[model samples]
Target: MSIWEMLAVFAAGISAGTINTIVGSGTLITFPVLLATGLPPVTATVSNALGLIPGSISGAIGYRKELEGQRPRVLKLTVGALVGGLTGATLLLALPSTAFETIVPVLVALALLLVILQPRISKAVQSRRARTGTPAHPDGGPLLFIGLTLASVYGGYFTAAQGIIYLSLMGMLVDDTMQRLNAVKNVLAAIVNSIAALFFLFVADFDWTAVVLIAVGSALGGQIGAKVGRRLSPAFLRALIVTVGTAAIVQLVLR
Candidate 1:
């Protein structure tokens, strides 16, 4: 890769790390950049997935305070995530790239819609919980498990707006503040990506140069996101998600 391409990948990594930490669709940033760098689609996806793992970890650590008392929740959801991730990764290897090419644009569009609607959905959930006197549980229940599993499958496959899907589900079902749910989203997303990355490490062809560039950049970006993201208004963050997610859809469709 040329110096310019390397710099571009690094910059994309930083942006992806920060966005992933704050929201969940950082893949939308890094994946396209990887493609532009001349990597094949599957190879780029694998490298991007592996490269972002460290950033995801860093972001999760940054939100450790919010993670308090959430161990049971994390543990309960992990099994489904692991299974879904493994399944998705295996499918990625087994299926033709054309399959994903046809499906992912729809997924990206759905994710964008979810991001746009999240606030209203969260308010409605909160209202229902208040009327029913429903107490919040750390464990998000079987429905959440199922929802997460499905989302993780998508994360394993492409992962552009998986975070939005997670946030939407968690926000409605978990009865928690968005901040706490964001932390949970990070951990769960990390789990999905990590599992997929492990599979790719053994089974896929990847570019180490891209991985290293993204990892280093994303790590730093994760810290920055954790520190700064908590201060932003939910409306602002939702707008950002919508904007980036829309861009991802356009890129996927136009490609």
Candidate 2:
């Protein structure tokens, strides 16, 4: 790759890491840059998945405080994510590139809608919980497990707004503050991405230079996001997610 291309990927990685830490959909920032560098779609997707793993890990660590008392929740949900991620990775390797391309825009659109309506959804969830006098299901019952598994499968396939999907679902079922639920979302996303990365590492052709650049940039960006992102207003963050998700849909359609 040319130095300019490398620089662009690095910059995209920084933006992706920060966005992933804050709200998700970081793939929208990085995937097109990889394509511009002349990688095939599958190669770019897999390489990007691997490159962002460190950033996901860093972001999860950055939210360690919020992770407190969430061990059982994390452990239980991780199983579903792992299985779903493996299933998605296998499908990615097995299916034609056109199949993934066809679905990604729809996924982005759904994520955008979820971001826009999350406040109403949260309120409804709170109201329902109060009316039923049922506590939040930390274990995330069968319905939550199924939903998470599906989201993980999507994350393994595209990874754009997987975090947004997770946040929306968890907000309804997990019965916690947004910040705490966000912490859980980060860890679950990391698990899904890590499983997919491992699959790609063993089975796919990837650009090592691009991966390295993204890893370095994303890792640094993760730390920056963790330190500063918590202060941002939820409204601002949700707006940012919607904007990026809309861009992702446009990019997919144009491509």
Candidate 3:
């Protein structure tokens, strides 16, 4: 790749890492840039998944304080992430590239919609619970496990706005502060990425250069995300993500 393309990928990695740490959906940033660099869809997905692993780990570590006393929760949810991630990775390899190409645009669009509507959804969920005077299941019950498992499968496959989905589900099912749920989100994301990437190593093709560039950059961004992301304006971040995601859709559809 040219120096310019390399730089672009690195920059996207930083952005994605930061975003993934804070809100999830960092893939939306890197995936398009990878495509712009001429990598095929499946290859880009695999590389992105592999590259973001470090970022996810870094973010989880940064949130260590919030993770206190959440071991049982983490352990239980981990099973789902592991199972779902493997399932999704298998699907990616089993499906034809043509199917992935067709389905991804639709998935990206849906993910963007979820990102856009996330706040309202959270508020609505909270309101419903309050109205019913229902208490949240300490372990998020079967529903959260199922929801997170499904989201992890999606993450393992495409690595898009799965974080947003994670937060949304946790928000609805678990009665915890956003920060704590976000901490768990990072852990789950790391697991899904790690598992899928490991699977890719055996059966999938990827661009090593893309993976390295994104890995280093995203790792740095994860630290920055943990330290600075909370201070940044939520609205601004959402707007930037939506803008980039829209461009990605255009690029994918045109190609």
Candidate 4:
């Protein structure tokens, strides 16, 4: 790769890291950047997945305060994400692109709709809980399992706005402040991306220049995302992510 290409990847990494930390949609940034640099679709997807692992890990670590008391829960739930991510990645490699293409638009649209409804739904759920005088959890085990499993499956497959899916699920199924759940989201997302990245690094062809550049920049941007997260209201960020995710879905649909 030329110096310019390496720089472009590094820039993409920074953009992805910040986007992932703040709003979720790091894939929307890095994936296209790599594709523009001439990687095949699958290769770009896999390589970006690997490179963005650090950003996820970084964001999780940055939220250590929120994670301080949630270790056991995180461990239990992380397995679902791990399994789902591997399943998704393997499917990506093994299944024909034609099959994936047919399914992705539907998934993306559904995911975006979830993103769009997050605020209103969360408020309504909270209001219902308050009126019922119930403790934080109203749904219990089956709901928790289903929600995590769904998030994991989505994370494993394609994590454009996986945060929205997780935030909505965790908000409904678990009782925690949005900030605290955000920490859990980072950890689960990290496990999904990090594991897939490790697999790709060992098995797939990658542009190492792109990987290194993105990894470094994303790591830095991730730290900043965590630092700034609470200061900024997430309403606008969610709106932007949904907008971009919708655009990406539209592009895919056209293709």
Candidate 5:
């Protein structure tokens, strides 16, 4: 790759890491940039997954405070993430590249809607629970587990907008502050990426240079993103998620 292209990928990595930490869909930034550099689609996807591991971990660490007392939830959800990630990674290798193309935008759009309506939805659920005299489950119950597992499968395949989906599900079901849900989102993202990367290491092709460049860049960006993300008001953060998610849908359609 040319020095200019290399710089561009590195820059995209930083931006992706920051955005992934704050909301999700960091892949939208880095994936196209990698493609512009002439990497094959599958190669770029695998390489990006590997490269972003550091960033995911970094972001999770940055949100460590918010992660407090969420151990049972994290641990339980991780089982689902691992299984879904493995399945998705396998499908990525086995299926044609375009297999998921038609449905991905629709899924992301739905996730965006959920994020937008989460407050009202949560309120309604809470009111219903009050009427029924039902106690809220600390770990978001089985439905959240199932929903997140399904989302993780997509994340394992193509990570763009995965965080948005996760936050949408967790925000509705978990009954926590958005920031705390985001914290869990980061951890789950880290797990899904890590597991997928591990799977790719054995069975997929990767551009080591791209991986190294993104790894370094995203790691730096993760810290930056966490710092900035923690400060935003929930309303502003929700707005940002909508904006980024809309852009992701447009980019996917154009692609």
Candidate 6:
């Protein structure tokens, strides 16, 4: 890639990392940026997955405190996440774009709706949970493996706003603090991207220079984002999702 492409990817990585750290829709930022650079849609998607792995890791680590007391939960759910992510990455590698093209926008729109309603949904969950007088541990955390697995699969494949899906699912099916749930979400998200990145490095096209720059930018952004994440209002991220997501959809449709 050219120097300009390197710069854009790096910038996108930082933005994505920060957003991931704060709100969990970082891919919605970088994926389109890569597409604008003339990469094929799936290629851009995979390359963006590779570039964002480090950022996801950094964000996961930054939220480690929230992961406490979740070992059993993580253990049970991570298997599904890992396996499903591998499958998702393989699907991306094996299938051509035609298979996913029609479905991609639908997924993005779902993510947008999830982000848009996250606050109200989360609040309502908390309120209902408070009145329920028991952890939603019915059938032991709801056996949400299928949902988690599917979510991870999506993350590995496209990963636009996988966090919103994660947040929404955990809110519904799992009995955990929102903070802890979000921590799990970040870790699992990284796992998906990490698996996809591994597959891409050995089997798919990549631009290592751009990946390096993006990783560095993402590293710094993750730290900064995690440090002051709580300061931002939901309105800010919602505005971002609407503006950026709408723009991305428009560009894709126009293309």
- All candidates' lDDT scores? 0.86, 0.85, 0.84, 0.75, 0.95, 0.73
**Candidate 2 whole-model C-alpha lDDT, 0 to 1:** 0.85
lDDT of 3 by residue, 1-255 (tens): 999999999999999899889877688789889999999888998999999999999989988888999999999999999999999999998877566557667766776776687678767877888999977678799998998898888778887767767876776567777678778989999999999999999999999999999999999999988887555465665665566567667766876
Across 1-255, the per-residue lDDT of candidate 5 in tens digits comes to 999999999999999999999999999999999999999999999999999999999999999999999999999999999998888899899999999877899999999999999999999999999999999999999999999999999999998899999999998898899999999999999999999999999999999999999999999999999999999999999999999999999999999
On TM-score, the leading prediction is 5
Q: What tens digits encode model 1's per-residue C-alpha lDDT throughout 1-255?
A: 999999999999999999999987788789889999999999999999999999999999999999998888888888988998888888889988777668777876876776677678767877877999986665778888998898888788887778878887776677677788888888988899999999999989999999999999999999999998788776777777677777777877887
lDDT of 3: 0.84
Model 2, 28-131: lDDT tens digits are 88999999999988899999999999999999999999899999989989999999998888889898767766877886687677667778886897788899
lDDT of 1 at 80: 87
Q: Looking at model 1, how many pairs of residues clash?
A: 0
All candidates in order of lDDT, best leading:
5, 1, 2, 3, 4, 6
lDDT of residue 83 for candidate 6: 86
Q: Candidate 5: lDDT of 231?
A: 99
Question: What are the root-mean-square deviations of the candidates from the true structure over C-alphas?
Answer: 2.0, 1.7, 3.2, 2.6, 0.6, 3.4
The residue-by-residue lDDT of candidate 4 on 228-248, one tens digit each, is 875555666566657767776
Clashes of each: 0, 1, 0, 1, 1, 0
Task: Give me the overall lDDT of model 1.
Answer: 0.86
> Which segments of candidate 5 are over 4 A away from where they belong?
none
Model 1 CA deviation exceeding 4 Å by range: 122-137
Better of 1 and 4 by lDDT: 1
Please identify which of the two predictions, 2 or 5, would achieve the higher TM-score against the true structure.
Answer: 5
